[model samples]
Target chain A: MKFLEPGLIALDVEAADGAAAIRAAGQLLVDAGAAESRYIDAMVASFEEKGPYFVLAPQIALPHAKPEDGVKEASVSLVRLREPVVFGHAKNDPVALVFALGASSSEEHITMLRKLTTLLNNPAHVQQLKDAPTPEAIGQLLEATTN
Target chain B: MKIICVCGLGQGTSLILRMNVENVLKDLGVSADVDHMDVSSASGTQADYIITNNELAQSLQGHAAKIVIVNNYFDLEEIKSSLQEVL
Candidate 1:
């Protein structure tokens, strides 16, 4: 699975809350032809229904709904927030990085996540992601780390 | 031991948790059949332990399987310690 495509990343973006963050992140997927426009709202609705489960870790969120919701292909989007937004997660709240995933199948989702597990499970990589200054830096980090 | 990883959609986060849990289990040399499922499918399924996020854990109360709530799906240390409790 491909990481954040060129132009699919937004750095220092502004989001009022988790929903807005999700929308901003999901729009990247839509704009890249990875998902339909409805996929964005579906992700927000999923968050509203499931609470903060989308907040995967501290300062990180993987907002996604089901594939049937509107995903056209498997892709990922990254948004580094200028200001953190609360997702109501007690342990992993006030997210600064939103990773909106669009996977068209469970197999594709797992393949993408397996690579992410290697990237996200490491604290050093997590810190690099948090401290990344630009989208290109984030892209470089992912390229070097995940595979 | 049988383990079930559940999320609302059954595919996204739960699958990530399952992957981490599997790694933790491997590291501990513990053998188990770990499965991932949707919240609705989880109701009918039975396992030695049910691992999920806090919100889904609430709805899974009174289940036959012991419930394990994990705050961060990517935290293997947290997962290992949590599994150590019941295993």
Candidate 2:
């Protein structure tokens, strides 16, 4: 089962800032038909209002908005940036990995979070994602997490 | 004790943190009603502890519940230690 569409996976992306990085990630969801374009704006606004709390770990970010924001379907997307962007997070700054989630309900969100946390808790798996040579390699890493 | 995990979106990162917090609390034999909430709505809710990162912790500084700032949400040890300090 492929939760992350092949088109949604990108490697070595260039982003100017954290919001730009999030936008790039969110765009993947848009292309996959999982989220509306306005969802990107909601994600950006949420980040601006609540600060960089989405920076889950060092070099990683999980950017998302409320289910009511603009979710068309439940999905997750990943973006690996060529250059890390400063998100103003104290410990987790200069994030190079962005994970954007679009869920239609809180249940879906929680379920996805459960799987994501399992993957994130392992430092080695996260390192693999950071050092993934290609988008396909990144997809394989994420697929392992889903299972 | 009711603990609320506050984040930008109620269901994303905060929910993940909530799960880790639940696990750590279980290991320590600490029982509490842990909830996940969004930053804006979290202000009005009641909780014994409001667990969040430094960014959102600022918004919840004066809340009645004790605010625990977690620098690394994925670091279970760090989370366990932080909870040990206040719990």
Number of the top-ranking candidate, with DockQ as the measure: 2
Clashing pairs in 2: none
User: Best lDDT goes to which candidate?
Assistant: 1
Error in Å for residue A117 of model 1? 1.4
What is the DockQ score, from 0 to 1, of model 1? 0.79
Best by TM-score: 1
lDDT of each: 0.87, 0.85
What is candidate 2's lDDT per residue for B1-87, written digit by digit as tens?
A: 899999876777888899999999999998899999887799999888999998778777778999998888889999999999998
Which consecutive 10 residues in model 2 chain B have the weakest lDDT in total?
B7-16
Give me the displacement of residue A56 in model 2, in angstroms: 1.8
Evaluated at residue A77, the lDDT of candidate 2 is 88
**DockQ for every prediction shown:** 0.79, 0.81
* True lDDT of residue A46, candidate 2: 82
